[model samples]
Target: MVIFGCVGIIAGCGSLGLWLANRIRRRPVELREFLMALSLLDTEIVWGATPLPEAFGILKERTDAPWQGFFADLQDRLQRGESASIAWNDVSLAQNSHFCLKHEDWQVIRDVSKGLGRSDRQEQHKQLELIQRQLALIKDQAGIWSEKQAKMWSYLGFLCGIAGVLILI
Candidate 1:
């Protein structure tokens, strides 16, 4: 029973560490997805000349979860007669908890909502391009940080588990 309990403790700690590491790794992937979705939105707005609600509907259909939800909510808000800027800002804030992005990423997103749908296609395109660039930089940094810290977090948890077992024994 004693040995089993120690093993359970070690396993639990190791699992927790792995989960945290997985979260770190997911951030870059999520950011990349967001970047792709933004590119799609740009295409819709620039070339297709789609309206905001229609573009958001397309995004809601094409994107994965979290992003899909974000666009869906934005589309719904727009359909309900809310201003584009308000819809974007409200959706971004309301769905903020669902995303794995960092503070800087959120800041760029917030900036995006500020000018959305308030300007001509040229201005919107420039704004979206700028946000995409910022997000790409953040994604690269997150990828590097995840590669370094994920292993450290996993090892730290296992080491702590081992220390606990040693002390108890």
Candidate 2:
């Protein structure tokens, strides 16, 4: 009877842990999809020689719903006397790399800004493509990480449940 009780407790905990992991794992993928879509638009704007501030602002305005929070945060950081690099660092911390900007992304931003002045649209486009590709790669890696973490959590939860049962026994 004690053994049975232990197994029941373990099973319950394992189920709960798996549920939580599944919930946590789903959002980042959606975020990545949204970011990938945004990257396409951003690439166009950058390559067209649009000013970085204007491009960012426009993108922020166009973004919708849950996704907007990140861009809004980025805009706020950028507006409050933060350099692009610093702003990106904050962004990297706040968001998963799939959706959040990074140092390299900022470098592209800086290059686009400079390229615009130099009328080097080609370079700006090239940089935009590079950034988009980087983001795509990050998104792919993030997907793998999320899946792996979810699996790990499930396995650990199972182990924990087994331990709990053994304790009761």
Whose TM-score is greatest here?
A: 1
- Clashes per candidate, residues 3 or more apart or on different chains: 0, 0
TM-score, predicted candidate 1 vs. hidden true structure: 0.96
Q: Where does the lowest 10-residue lDDT sum fall in candidate 1?
A: 107-116
The TM-score that candidate 2 achieves is 0.57
- List runs of model 2 lying over 4 Å from the truth: 1-12, 27-31, 34-38, 47-50, 61-67, 94-122, 141-145
Residue-level lDDT tens digits of model 2 in 45-160: 55555655555566667776444565676668777867655665566456644433335434433343333323455665666566566556666766777788888888888888
Candidate 1: stretches off by over 4 Å: none
Q: Give per-residue CA lDDT, model 1, range 28-107, as digits (tens).
A: 99999999999999999999999999999999999999899999999999999999988888888899898877877888
lDDT (CA) for every model shown? 0.90, 0.61
Q: What's the residue-level lDDT of 135 in candidate 1? A: 92
